[model samples]
Target: MYGLIGKIQVVPGQRDALIAILLDGAREMPGCLSYVVAQDSTDPDAIWVTEVWDRQESHAASLTLPSVQQAMARGKPLIAGFSERCETVPVGGHGLATVP
Candidate 1:
């Protein structure tokens, strides 16, 4: 699986519009299993998106599409800052019980 966790700083009053675009696209993304978008409880302008793709290829393919690119373009103006220091997560590491 492929996943990402980061914060997208959106312009005032434009968060809703940006999220709508991302969520809509995620649903249609070729390998997307689930794409979750959330707002920071402390900051309304801070947005977070967690995406899970069936495989690495699907996520990569989505990046080449026009609609997805356009969605990003729409938020370019609203973005005040971006936490882009994300990395590829290890596959199938979920639900491993850790000893407390």
Candidate 2:
């Protein structure tokens, strides 16, 4: 399994709009095991996105998807910057199908 955890900084008061775009794009992703978006507890302009995929290739391929491309286009202007991004080899998790 493959995973990614990242923090994104968005323009002030635009976090909700960006989150909506992200969630919409995530809906139909092939091979996506889990995708979560959360607001940062201490930062109004920061959001956290965590994703799990069946394989690394699936993650890479998702980037070329139309839905993802649209989301990127819609969300790009709202983004201020990226703070942290980490890649991981997922083993198992409570809600992840990989937990078998």
TM-score against native, each model: 0.77, 0.94
Best by TM-score: 2
Residues 56-85, candidate 2: write the lDDT tens digits.
988899999999999999999999999999
**Cα lDDT of model 2 overall?**
0.91
53 in model 1: Cα distance from truth in Å? 1.3
Residue 43, candidate 2: how far off, in angstroms? 0.4
lDDT of each: 0.73, 0.91
The CA lDDT at 70 in model 1 is: 83
Question: What TM-score does candidate 2 reach?
Answer: 0.94
Weakest 10 consecutive residues of candidate 1 by summed lDDT:
91-100
How well does candidate 2 score on lDDT at residue 65? 93
